[model samples]
Target: MFIISLTYKTSLENVERYIPGHNLFLQKYYDSGQFIASGRKEPRTGGIIIANAQSMNEAEQIISEDPFYIHQIAEYEITEFIPTKYNENFKIFIED
Candidate 1:
């Protein structure tokens, strides 16, 4: 199943500050077949991340690992997702 994570940063500044750490985590996870994609929201709010997990509980646990979450830079509102449509060539969407 998929999980849609809606993250709201305490401030875009904080988001930026923690982005590098969080990004590395996302990259490692995605490469290992955990997170599919993760990036900042349009206008620079926080980020929207799509992840593949065995269960909602696992998804939540994964979200908890984000540096932003640990540093109090962002708060995540995560939910189960059914991604019926996806663009594999968009460069942002990865099955992993």
Candidate 2:
């Protein structure tokens, strides 16, 4: 699993301009089972994405296709982690 953090580098005006396309990009990945969960941050500065990828390279390749990255509207920070423990309801997230 990977936690993808997006920090806006540009103004909201710039970010909004690409939201539609960005959403489409996100939806495509969600449909493909690459992205599990995603949403904007509390203060709306950026967003977060929980995804499954074979490796960091694969994660980067997936993120590279995001419209936000393509337009340089935000900077991305990816953190990879192993889910060793979680609630039963969360088990699905860690399953193979």
Candidate 3:
């Protein structure tokens, strides 16, 4: 699993301009089952994405495809983790 944190480097006006494109990017990954969940952070600073990429390389590649990354709208911080325990329904997103 990966916790993809995004911190805005630019103004909200700039971020809003790319949100539509960003939503499309997110939908593409969601359709591929790579993105588990994503949303804006409180105080509206940036956003977070819970992704199910198999490795750090894969995760980085995924991030590379984001409009935010391409436009340098935000800084990315990716943290990879092992899910020791999760809800039974969440097993579908977990890998052995």
Q: What TM-score would every model get versus the actual structure?
A: 0.76, 0.95, 0.96
The digit string of per-residue lDDT tens for model 1 on 26-85 reads 988889777766766787766677777878899888878878778877777777766667
Q: How many clashes show up per model? A: 0, 0, 0
Q: Which sections of candidate 1 miss by over 4 Å?
A: 83-96
Q: Candidate 1: deviation at residue 25, Å?
A: 1.0
Locate the minimum summed-lDDT window of 10 residues in model 3. 87-96
lDDT of 3: 0.95
Each candidate: RMSD to true structure? 3.6, 0.9, 0.9
Q: Compared with the true structure, what per-residue lDDT tens digits does model 3 show for residues 1-96?
A: 999999999999999999999999999999999999999999999999999998999999999989999999999999999989999999988855
Candidate lDDT scores, in order, read: 0.71, 0.94, 0.95
Q: In candidate 2, what residue range of length 10 has the lowest lDDT sum? A: 87-96
TM-score of 3: 0.96
lDDT at 50 for candidate 1? 72
- lDDT of model 2 at position 85: 82
Evaluate residue 52 in candidate 3 and report its C-alpha lDDT on the 0 to 100 scale: 91
Winning model by lDDT = 3
Stretches off by above 4 angstroms in model 2 are none
From the highest TM-score down, the ranking of the candidates is 3, 2, 1
- Model 3 residue 49 CA deviation in Å: 0.3
